[model samples]
Target chain A: MSDLLEARSVSRSFGGLHVTRDVNFKLTTGDRVALIGPNGAGKTTLVNLITGDIAPSEGQFFMGGDEITGLSIPDRVRRGLVRTFQTTRLFANLTVADNIALAIMQRKRITRRFFSSSTELPEVRAEWSEILSHLGLDRLAYRKVVELAYGQQRLIELAIGLALHPKVLLLDEPAAGVPHDEAPRILEAINRLPSDIAVLMIEHDMDLVFKFAKRVLVLAAGRLIFEGSPDQVTADHEVRRAYLGSYADARRPT
Target chain B: MSDIAVTHVPHKRNIPFAQEAAGALVILALGAIGWFLYPDDLAFLTRLIGIAFLVLSLDLVTGYCGVATLGHAAQFGVGAYAAGIACIRGVSDPVALLAVGLCAGTVMGLISGALITRFRGLPQLVLSIAVGQLIAGLANKLSWLTGGSDGLSGIEPGKVFGVFGFDMYSRTAFVFSLGVLVITFVVLQRFVRSPFGLMCRGIKDDDLRAKMIGVSIYPRLVVMYGVAGAVAGIGGALTAISTGVVGLDSVSFERSAEVLVMLVLGGAGHLWGALAGTVIFMIFEHIVAAANPFHWMTLVGLLLILIVVFAPRGLIEPVVLLWAKFKRKGSAV
Candidate 1:
């Protein structure tokens, strides 16, 4: 399949520190990719570069063929490049439904209608109800985001990402702060995302990476060292030495 | 998940449908109380109405959009001068003057908003103060056009609609100001509950997330600044028209600070809170200033301290809480 998103030689550095270095990757429709890396490996930075949160020092990113390096963060999101934070960033004071409704309003471009009630708008009501319900969060719709459990907030993050109608969704550790037992529900929600959209998850959880990602990309010290199927990732000698060596050897390998 | 009929949300939605109508009624009721209590002092009430617009406008940018400003009177002053200049040049109709004020305010809002939205937090606040001082200075310097520091006079507004002439009782000005306030309140109430307004709240709550969700924060804030400007402009125009004079006070730095005080006194963010703040602050100021001519400042200071200490959110939050409690008790019974 043709690429939905492509980052060509994308690199970023803060002063002398090379946070993201010459990382080239392409995501096709329905691609399930988990990006695994050690601390300071620039996994989140790569996501930021693609999302237009930070600019690349040398390289360009494209969505379906259009160079999006020049676009603003919101404009890139408008073009269907969306992401969720490692730490849940939600409208903490607003209800869950309102948070989801904001994404829906932006998607439909109804955020400019200034004379009607937002909640009573039939289209908004329908969208949030459906989206939240699908994520099994309809029960928490009226609750303020600040009042929600950490795992549920993460689920709301996924719900919001889904609401944006993203073509390429970058989830930066969707279950990072989630309790051990509740992490799977978040994974379940992640699995339930629309099939046609490409999903790139930045995760350290090997079990989740194995289960959710069809292919795994390993990064170490700001470089793409390996990109292969989950099975092949452990077998690659260089990949084992640089980063996944101890974990892979411990999990089930030789 | 199959058995869950999740379409119908069970929680009681607090977003009332009759908000605009209810708001209009409340404003009218407030106007009537002012009318009865201070029948002879209609000019005082009219002045309150004029300042109410400024407070409401302040609420729009500061309370709703999350843009901290100390220079809101920049728009209010521009609007006053616009209406006053338009009238002096021959726009005699009251409605026409208000329109001039609205356009001028919106333009001023766009200009100031463009500059102010560039920074966040303290720098933004300082920038707003600078903008206000700049506008007020410009007004003071333009003596030929604005009557300089002496204030602009010779503003003779024709009949309300070319039929209802302003009588000696100051009845026309009071009623007109109140009518404008009620209409603006209803409209702003609607605006606050709309998608655009909610998006602004999203920005106020968390702008980065708003941007991540595809919200263009700058443009929305600029547009809201324009909306806020239009509201403040109308207030300035009303002040000029009702009193038949315009001066440096209209665009003064103190006017910006005082309007903000009023918004904070009543509440910020909620439309009614702005109106409530204006009423409480003005009335308390009036009564205290009357009771103690020399030490009036101390009393007002005490009141502000009391309110801020007891009700950090604003004067309205406690009432709203009590109201919610009262209703719950009623429902329980």
Candidate 2:
């Protein structure tokens, strides 16, 4: 099977420090990959490179065999590759439902007519209601996004990503600021999503990285160190020594 | 179990009809009153409406869509020149002149919009001002076509629909100008409620996120700016019809700035705010100018300063606040 996303000899640097250096990575279609790394390991930068937010200093990125390294972020999204931010980006003044509806409308043919009604389309309305209902956001549909709790805002972000209808969803620390109690629900939402859309998730939580991802890739100091199952990763000696040593005892639930 | 069930059904969307009819009635009443009274200064009032329509166009782009434009007067001038040049060449039909003006305005707007939207922030404003100056320069250089600062003259009001001959009287002009204003206002209202307008709002709020969600900002702004130009072009042609002349002042920076002030003074985001601001600013200008020439500009400057400092939402918001307070007081009593 071929990888749905591929990076070849990707390296990016700022000033003297080498943030990412000659990293090669791949994710097969429908692959659930967990990227685990210590702080400042260039995990987020890798995601940015893949999504075309920043060009690699040296290397190429291909999505479904198409060179996407030079494409604009919006054009990359239209080609079915998208990335979410570490912090949520929702239109604070718009309603939760409107935020989703606006995303869906972006995919349609936009004309220059002064009086044509784009919102009156039945399909657009149905998709809006469907996304809202599927995400359990029906009750907060009309409420302003700023009024929602932090967790709810994160869900809105996920809903926004869902509306893009991307084939690959890149989540950058989605559960970072979410509460302990609500984190599982969000994780469960990701777990329950359809298997067609490949997910590349960057997380610090060992349990979350273990619970949801089928394949694990570890990064340390902007380099890919290991790739295997969670059990194989937990049992590796060097992998345990370099990063997982601190979490060794904490890996098992009390 | 003692209560009987009842059903409620909508009686045919009365709000849209009522709003439309009320707007039409107001315009008609104003026309009838102007015709009967035949105020000696009715021409001035008709000219005010024409200028107000131009300001409304500026308000839609700058206020509603968050497009920072400093050169829309170029569009107004293009329409005026197109219509004037057409008339001077014996193409005296009003409908033909209107179509010509609209086409000229649309082309100018699209070209300028494409150029300006490529650059962002202060660069956008600077580029627009440069485009404005470019048009103004062309108008000055094209001496034969534009009359070269001597000003275009010998314009006759001709006839409406080639049937009712327009006379020196302001009655026909007033009615025609009022009809155009009502139509423009209704179309703008519907536009702001549509999905395209909503996406523009989203773009204004956050361009990056809008892009992430697949909203292309540049092309959208270009289209909207073009539409706004078409509307303002009509306004310029209307001004030509009423005044029977086109002057360099139609493309002045001061004219553009004054319209911006009217928009900010009326309120942003609300279409009626633009209309209300135009009306108030025109009335204010008329009263103050009548008192003294310098007093008109100075008074507008002072009023704008006060509004910016005290009530930045414009006069409409303050009026709404006061009305709400009065209602609450009456209910308490």
Candidate 3:
């Protein structure tokens, strides 16, 4: 199967500290993977490199087998590589529906004629209704994003990424601050997403990671330490010593 | 960010159908009464309206589009010069004046917008200032045609479509300017309510996100700036035709800053905010100057600082917020 995204020997450094070193990774079609690491493991750097947020110091990255290491962030997104920030980046002043609507509107041309009457476009309006209804945000669609609860905000972020129509979605941290009950729902939503859309997420919650991700890759201090099933990841001595050391403590509600 | 929940107060009042009709009728009636009663002052009032229209254009760019411009007056000056030069060279037709002014303003705005777009932060502000200075200097250096500091005088604007008999009595001039001002206001109000305006607001809030979604910020901002410049150009042309003079003051930096203040004082995001700000500021200036010109500047400065600090949303927003607060207390939402 063709890899949806691939990064070969990608390395990045901030000054002398090697944030990411010789990090080779690939995401196959329909693959769900988790990038697990302790604090400052350079998981985000690897994601940034693959997503074209930052270029690798000495490596190649590809999307659908085309070199995209030099593409701008927007250009990369246009090629079906999109990402979400760990910190939710919502338009604070705009309503929830308007936020998603903006994403839809920008996907088309920007002529005065096209833009002048976009609000009434039949297709656009229908898509907006469908997206909002699916996310259970139809009631608060008109409310400003800042007024939404944290959980709702995260869902809105997910919806925004979905509206981009990306082939590969890179989620920085999907369950970072989600409540236990909410984490299951987020995982369920991810599992139920269309099979064509591949997801690669950086997560700290092993429970949620094991539940959703079919394949897992563990990073330790800027290097790939383990790449296997959830059971293999838990049994690996180095993975247990480094990442799962606090797994038992994290069992408590965050 | 805290929700001061109290009641469901609509953004506007829900008056009875009859009451809404009556309110519109009353306003029109009063306007008619004032129109005839103050015929002599109509010329001044009309000129004020034209100036207000220009400020409204600035409001659209700065307030709506979130573009900080310091060379807007240069665009206004380009319009005045285009119209004045056209008139002196025998194109005394109003339509010709408007066409030339609008085209000139739009061209200048697009050029300047393109030039300053690549620079952000302090560099962008500096580039805008430099653009204004360059245009003004060019006007001054091209002395023989522009008439330099003395300005283009002896501009005898012909009657509107050669029918109104635009003599020095100024009656036709006032009516013509007023008619143009009202039309411009209607057209601009529509423009703001359109999808383009909403996209401009979206860009203002977050240009990066807008671009990620596929809206290139640069091209849209340039087009908006050009439209606003074209509108402002009309106001400058009105000033020249009605008053029959164009001076260095037309392209002065102070003029640019004053229009910005007018937009800010009225309200940043509201359409009528610029209009209200222009009217209030002009009346205040006129009243203050009649008593003591120097003291009026100081008072205006102090008042602007107070407004910026106390009512950061401008005069209109504060009033709306206060009204909302009171209504919330009264309702049981």
Off by over 4 Å in 3: A110-120, A178-181, A248-254, B1-37, B167-169, B319-333
The global Cα lDDT (0 to 1) of model 1 is 0.89
Each candidate's fnat, listed in order, reads 0.87, 0.42, 0.25
Candidate achieving the largest DockQ: 1
Ranking by DockQ: 1, 2, 3
Q: Categorize the docking of model 3.
A: acceptable
Query: In candidate 3, what are the lDDT values of residues B147-225, reduced to their tens digit?
Result: 8988888667777887986756567777677667666666675577456777787888876666555566788888887
Residues B1-333, model 2: lDDT tens digits = 232111111111124446556756765676567566757878877887887777777876777667787888888889888888888888887767777787888888788889987887899899888998888888887889998686677766568887866567676787778887788777776777577877777777777888787666788888878887888888888887777888888888877777878888898666767777887898888889989986678888899999989979987788766865785576446
Pairs with steric clashes in candidate 3: none
Tens digits of lDDT, candidate 1, A117-136:
88657788888899887777
Runs with alpha carbons beyond 4 Å of true place in candidate 2: A110-116, A234-245, A252-254, B1-40, B316-333
Model 3 chain A — which ten-residue stretch has the worst lDDT?
A109-118
Question: What is the Cα root-mean-square deviation between model 2 and the actual structure?
Answer: 4.6
Candidate 1: give the clashing pairs: B152-B246, B266-B277
Candidate 2 on A71-134: residue-level lDDT in tens? 8888888887877778888877677767877878776645233455444445665676677676
- Cα lDDT for residue B299, candidate 3: 90
Worst 10 residues of 3 chain B by lDDT: B1-10
Candidate 1 Cα misplacement greater than 4 A, ranges = B1-6, B11-17, B322-333
